[model samples]
Target: MAKNKDVRVTVILECTSCVRNGVNKESTGISRYISQKNRHNTSSRLELKKFCPYCYKHTVHGEIKK
Candidate 1:
């Protein structure tokens, strides 16, 4: 059987701008995205530019602990 650990793991990406500002103009919550990354490939935290509906713009999204 496969072990608990896997090569690819699920991760949550949160908007940094919204987190720092602590407010969302369009909505009442911060924007978040679900994504997956290879654990072996990315040893460090992942950051990506994604569209935030609450902010209504593209912002830097960083990986957060589950």
Candidate 2:
């Protein structure tokens, strides 16, 4: 018998359904600032939890690769 192991590096995200309540105009600036911060400093994925302004809830999902 062998132990099962699972590891992941990256996965597709559905960020269109996140509930954005506390987000403000300043967030827009912050997002832009972050992009500029990573322009040449590093190669990291700036994963954002964008909330859906319409649905008023966070509905984003994550799936494991097979």
How do all models score by TM-score?
Answer: 0.89, 0.25
Lowest summed lDDT window (length 10), candidate 2 = 29-38
Return the lDDT, model 1, position 27: 80
Candidate 2 structure quality by residue, lDDT tens digits, 1-66: 877433333444333322234444433311111112232443454455544444444444332222
lDDT tens digits, residue span 17-56, model 1: 9999977655889989999999999999999999998988
Model 2 deviation from native, Cα RMSD in Å? 12.2
Candidate 2 stretches with Cα past 4 Å from truth are 1-14, 18-36, 59-66
RMSD of 1: 1.6
- In the order shown, the candidates' Cα RMSDs to the true structure are 1.6, 12.2
The backbone clash count of each candidate, in order, is 0, 6
